[model samples]
Target: EREWPLAYVPLLIDEKEWAEISAGLVQRADLFEAILADIYGPNRLIEKGILPAGLIAASPEYLRPIAGIRPASGHFLHMVAFELGRGPDGRWW
Candidate 1:
């Protein structure tokens, strides 16, 4: 596959997989929403020692210098792209 977002996925012959993929898409959206919310908020997981602080601090993907600068629309990501795959345990990854 192209690793493109679901919005860009073209029609295929796998109609039986439609419902499964749709459910996965919904779940992926929910995960993105939760991650965004946690990152910008109190961040209990990071504060409580559940997740490592280095996880965010060392990520070059997030520019920390831009914190608190809200855009006019007040949303960091007006558009988000998500791709889904499975873990070795047969669970969603």
Candidate 2:
């Protein structure tokens, strides 16, 4: 099933709706960048008591095996996924 895929009907949105969706996506990406930066950088949240140090260490997503190995490009948390949703008005945007 992974080798082949089915095509879906093309989605068409007005410029206004497209702009709203694009802005939301960009904002979310920026937020992810900030969170990742804090986690792998200075860790101000843990220092300032906003986030518990124990929680981060206990999380399964925290990769202890590769703790010391930094990416040459200095990038982490490279994947982000969002659910497609609609409001009560039934608009995807």
Candidate 3:
């Protein structure tokens, strides 16, 4: 059998801090969606030299076979998880 580790104590945050964090996360998600849409669709980032074609092509996560396929939900990413860590300065990175 496998067991999952759980935290007994919850980390608390003030409303203002939570709002800032939430906004940053939303912005990150939006950026990810835009990047994914571009790479799989028009690829304007690569075409405009904002991103190198070779770099994206070499990535393991880049799926060349499904480049032009559209998702039923009309979004490439339905959900995403981010691994966050606090820096030495006590700021979340």
Candidate 4:
């Protein structure tokens, strides 16, 4: 398997459990939004739960430093995997 992971959320959550679970989203969003705002003047949805931290971090392509700062725009996994070969330092970028 390339990767395996598990996540659990209360899509069918009860009213009493709703607030508690969602609370973490609020707190997490606050922290995330603050960081983004400081960087990009508030990224709207990225500040909301709609966009996730891992997604932004996992974005295979992006140039926040080279583009966001320097400009000219930017953006995926620029990685390569060998069929059955491997090397210690030739790891994926």
Candidate 5:
């Protein structure tokens, strides 16, 4: 399949647009890291009356198979990606 035909067009983004996109991605990654820390640790978000316990209980992907398995060295989130695209209205999502 190495010689399979492919169709692609190069995207041209300005420096300002790239900066905005990068900022949004970094913010999302930071949020995910905080959430993972809460889920695997003391869960102060729930204890402090911030996040509802039922919300966690109802999540399908909540700690099920790997309930008590801690990370190798306290590193929870290893990798993450955001599939963003510019919308018709020139908004990145």
Candidate 6:
């Protein structure tokens, strides 16, 4: 097996940039939580045609057995991580 490569230099971010990134991450997490909840709960997105039923049905991540079951914590997602990279144009994408 090949060993994974590591970055020798640490990437640093300014406080202002970090603040913006953090805010965007939080917003995205909230949206993900809502989408998961909807998929496992009412599934109105499918009914309303906002999301295709076959898409969820075919998704490996979709657990049909757990549909409509509320978690004890009352939230579907507790934590999330995102991989962000800067494009050649110097914009984060």
By TM-score, who's the top model here? Answer: 6
C-alpha RMSD by candidate, in order: 5.9, 5.1, 4.3, 15.7, 5.7, 3.1
* Candidate 6 structure lDDT: 0.88
Q: TM-score for all predictions?
A: 0.55, 0.69, 0.78, 0.33, 0.68, 0.84
lDDT value, candidate 4, whole model: 0.47
Candidate 3: segments with Cα more than 4 A from true spot: 1-8, 86-90
Residue-by-residue lDDT tens digits, candidate 1, 1-93? 665444556546356666777777778777776565566655676888877879887887766756445546655555767655655785544
Better of 2 and 6 by TM-score: 6
Q: What is the lDDT of residue 67 in candidate 4?
A: 26
The ten-residue window of minimal lDDT in model 5 covers 1-10
Pick the lDDT winner. 6
- lDDT of each residue in 53-89, candidate 5, tens digit only: 8988899868755645677776578899776666689
* Local lDDT at 43 for model 3: 90
> Candidate 3 at residue 3, lDDT?
50
lDDT of 2 at 63: 73
Better of 2 and 5 by TM-score: 2
Candidate 3's displacement at residue 76, Å, is 1.0
TM-score for model 3? 0.78
Model 2: residues with Cα > 4 Å off, grouped in runs: 1-10, 65-70, 90-93
Give the deviation of candidate 1 from the true structure as CA RMSD. 5.9
Model 1 segments beyond 4 Å from truth?
A: 1-16, 65-93
Candidate 6 residue-wise lDDT, 1-93, digit = tens? 335454668779889987988899999999999999999999889889999999999999899999989999999998898976676897666
> What RMSD value applies to candidate 2?
5.1
Q: Assess candidate 1 and give its TM-score to the true structure.
A: 0.55
Model 4 TM-score relative to the real fold: 0.33
Candidate 4 off by > 4 Å? 1-11, 41-93
Per-candidate local distance difference test: 0.64, 0.75, 0.86, 0.47, 0.78, 0.88
